[model samples]
Target: MNTTILDMVKIEVTKLLAVGIIYPISDSHWVSLVQVVPKKYGMTVMRNQHDELVPMRIQNSWQATRKDHFPLPFVDQILEKLARKSHYYFLDGFFGYMKIYIAPEDQHKTTFICPFGTFAYTHMPFDLCNTPSTFQRCMTSIFLDLL
Candidate 1:
């Protein structure tokens, strides 16, 4: 039996969910976050911070308008710290690709839509408003004793 495009998309998405790459979002609105893009292979879409599908025209607009005021460490400060250490051991967190568990109560806020269905993230998504700060906080909490 030949699987239709929707069926194929569903299969791929299901695999992603099974592996903890994504989670289901129960109370999701279609119009708010689901945009269907035309593709030959299968369904494709752009997920926004609210886990919504972003239309092409509005996607750029949204990105340009969003403001993140979270403060990052100054490069000079980091450089000074590094220079103080004679031997520096670098632990790569894969460019800050750390796994951050999402709170159960707030998981719904990360819901997004695909061609087949809606899903939420079990781990922190990079697009969240305060992801950098949140990640930094987590790191600080974990390494406080060591530091």
Candidate 2:
């Protein structure tokens, strides 16, 4: 594959928001140009600087198979325990805007390839193994006194 062409196509799609068109150039070769869209679902393929292929959103396929057995408190239980409270302070943006950093050495594990180029995430992404558990662990550590 002519990766240069693929890279250029990716850049146009991502940076320029251009629409992609596919055409069969030869009996054995087909060329496709695509536009990058905000991901609601599905997977994207990207390359790293090492010219490796990384597939994004592949976690969607395995998400259904993951089991949650972490020792997290149930919401109902917390509510029951706090029933005697006179006033309650509701905290907004508890987990909504939290940022988790990824270790530099492990950032490569989060690398993904796009038609334009390969990139790595500097922060923890939503779609990763044990993400919920990891987040829960962090939240627990932060709110240990409250919990």
> Which candidate tops lDDT?
1
- Report lDDT (Cα) of residue 49, candidate 1: 38
Considering only N, C-alpha and C atoms within 3 Å, which residue pairs clash in candidate 2?
10-116, 20-33, 45-113, 46-113, 46-114, 47-113, 47-118
**RMSD for each model, in Å, please?**
7.6, 12.1
Model 1 accuracy (lDDT, Cα):
0.59
lDDT of 1 by residue, 103-123 (tens): 877666667765567787677
Model 1 TM-score (2 dp): 0.56
**lDDT (tens digit, per residue) of candidate 2 on 72-135:** 6688987986897776665433232226666766555554444444445455544455556667
The Cα error of candidate 1 at residue 7, in Å, is 13
Task: Say which candidate scores most in TM-score.
Answer: 1
Question: Which pairs of residues have clashing backbones in candidate 1?
Answer: 23-120, 33-52, 33-53
- Candidate 2 Cα misplacement greater than 4 A, ranges: 1-69, 82-98
Error of 2 at 97 (Å): 7.5
lDDT, candidate 1, at 102? 78
